[model samples]
Target: MTLRVRDLDPENPADLDGITAVLRAAVPPMLVTPELLWWQSARAPAAQCHRLLLAEDEEGRVIGRGSTGLAHESPEPGLAFCNVYVHPEHEGRGAGTALVSAAEEYLASIGARTAFSWVLDGERNLGFARRSGWSPSRSARFQRLDLTAPLRPLAPPPPGVELRPATAFADDPRPLFLLDAEATADEPSDVGTELDDYEEWLATSWGHPLLDRDLTTVALVDGVPAAFSIAHTDGADRYSSGMTGTARAHRGRGLAKLAKHDSLSRARAAGLTEAYTSNDTENAPMLAINEWFGYVPAVTEVRHAKPLG
Candidate 1:
């Protein structure tokens, strides 16, 4: 039976559910759902130019999924990404290869000169990526913490520091945005991103459907947002940290830890059962913070890259 690859029709309910199932099958811990997929592919900032693709077998069952797009926020030219995930039950059917090919074609059509993707840290996935001309790069560790466990109480903030919910700045999140941009610039990554567009940041990050401003914690210095722990909820019991960082000037003050601790405590109080976060293995500071919070490593993913001709 022949396998075919095509763009996912988000408008079609079956296609949406099929792709969501494929994602869940590939990574059971992922918080992906049809609603989240739609939010990403259809409502994300226009600069992202996101595309979703699906691979179907002769019987029209979706066995693989691919997400592709240009990294619009990056100052570099011709930079793109394509993440492919195939159901474990259908691995030998060439669905992954087909999906990658289609994704690359789409990226090239949009003038992308390079592509990046994440492959699970395993021999099979690594071999497949190497076979596709992708070379290994920096890796990231995903961690999870059980909210049901006894959490360490958050220590009081320093005399001049204040910890509060991000929602307090709903009328003006510019201070938080500035802190995020500064922290993001210093984060360890193969692809350096510059968040120069505040409007774009507002639309994509601030207005995101999953963003839980009420649960997100922020540490302020003299009323200026200096550190934050952004939160995203699955509308269930699962919560994920979108980004946690402290401004350069506030790095040694333990503000990031304070914000994260406050956020996690609030999350547990709000009945959130699970919390997840990921960090570059090279980021010693953040890793140490996660360790202090009792977050255990769940999965490791290796970043891979290939040049486009």
Candidate 2:
């Protein structure tokens, strides 16, 4: 069957559903929806040159999807990402190769000097990356919790500390922004990111379509935002932790763990059946916290990079 890759039309409902289907099939634990895909494609920062590409067969069925864009927030310049996911049923049909080639061509056209992709840790995936001239760099773990199962009870905030939902700061999210920026900078990754753009963060993260402000818990120390567990729900049973971190000054205080427990409790009470989260292998603190919460290993993916010349 002849295959072709093309840019997705975010405004097209069929395209949105098609891509969402492929993504859900490829990464089941991810909290993704048609709306989230639309928001990512439409509201992506222009500097990133983000493109959601779709691979279709001659029969016009979507068999693969690719999300490619520059790492504009990285301190290092000209770094780009091209993550391609082909529907499992369509694997080995050349869809993955076609999508990757199209994504690389686009990245290079936009002045990218290097490209990075996350390959699910497996012989087939690793072999594909190697044959495509990409080498493994780092690995991250995806974890899942059966929210329907009993969860650790939420602990009362210690004296001088208070827990609040992220929506409480809707009037002014700058405090949460500051905490997120600090935590994000310290996250382990191949491409280091610096969240220096407040307006950009507000647009991309604060106002994201899937951000469940009510489920996102934040801990305040003496009325100062010290730790937070950002939550994203698919407006259904699926929920995922977008980011969970504590300010540098509040480390070892158990604030991050507290925030996550409260957030998970809220999610479970609100009928979210499953909770998913990911952590870089180097992020021991977060990993430990997840394990303590009864999240079991789900899958692992290795970051692979290739030079663009």
Candidate 3:
């Protein structure tokens, strides 16, 4: 019963099914499909440096998987991530450790100075990471909203801001991309990310399949994009907010709330009955906005960091 780690080909349907199963088992609250998995791997920026590795048992079943690479946009270089997941039923079979070892070696080969991972908050999960030289650093919560239930009527757009759909930028989306990059930098997190490569951004984010351009809401202020709430759907009732953020300069104006409300209203109208989103526990402002929109915490995941020797 040997375990081996190898690259996962997005073009292969079997790879996607295996990866999706691991994702669902590891993080059941987060929705995933073949389309979403392929889109994510296929569109990763070749320059920013992304890699997805899968662990297979002797029988050729994927028992674990990891995504390892450097976040080039981050101001700090060598910042890499690798989350290894072993199916709950197959824990302690050496698959998880083997997966992490492969991911770490790959990241180190790519000049990664630090490796980050998200571990499901629990005794066994945390203990595994600790034994492997990883330490808890930060935490985040996943929340879900019942879109089918009655929701508070969203207020009209403010005096100078207008609620608009992201589809409006289809003709030219560079502006929205720039806004997304800017807003992401201000987000509270243990791993600070900076979006520097435009082309990679186009491939990884702009080219995502689940991104619902029509349902994403952007708040415009005098022709400028101040805030936005991005939505991703799985062609069914499940919907997720990729991000909802307001520009630093426009933080006090409640544009994030306005944008998110518009997004939720549009999502409900579009037949999405369930909405899920995650937020850093320290991001009080964003959490408040989500709570206002009827989002309730569903799960907690902890960020773990391991310093290389």
TM-score of each candidate structure, all chains considered together: 0.97, 0.99, 0.95
Highest TM-score against the true fold, candidate: 2
Q: Cα miss at 76, model 1 (Å)?
A: 1.4
Record all residue pairs in model 2 with backbone atoms less than 3 Å apart, i.e. clashing: none
Q: Which ranking of candidates, highest lDDT first?
A: 2, 1, 3
Candidate 2 residue 275 C-alpha distance from true site, Å: 0.4
lDDT string, candidate 2, 1-309, tens digits: 899889999899989999899988988877789998999999999999999999999999999999999999999999999999988889999999999999988888889999999998899989999999999999998999999998877668889999999999999999999999999999999999999999999999999999999999999999999999999999979889999999999999999999999999999999999999999999999999999999999989999999896
Off by over 4 Å in 3: none
Q: Provide C-alpha RMSD values for all models, in order.
A: 1.2, 0.8, 1.5
Q: After superposition, how far is residue 54 of candidate 3 from its true place, in Å?
A: 1.3
Choose 1 or 2, whichever is better by TM-score.
2
Per-residue lDDT of candidate 3, residues 1-309 (tens digit): 798889888999998899889888888778789777776677776655777888889999987878877766678877888888878877889988888898888888878888889998889999999999998988999999999987787668768888889889888888888899899988987778777667667777777788888889999998889899999988888889999988878988889888888888888988889999999999999888889888998989899888764
Task: Extract clashing residue pairs from model 3.
Answer: 73-194
Which prediction has more favorable TM-score, 2 or 3? 2
Candidate 2 vs candidate 3, lDDT winner: 2
Ranking by TM-score: 2, 1, 3
Model 3 worst lDDT run, 10 consecutive residues: 39-48
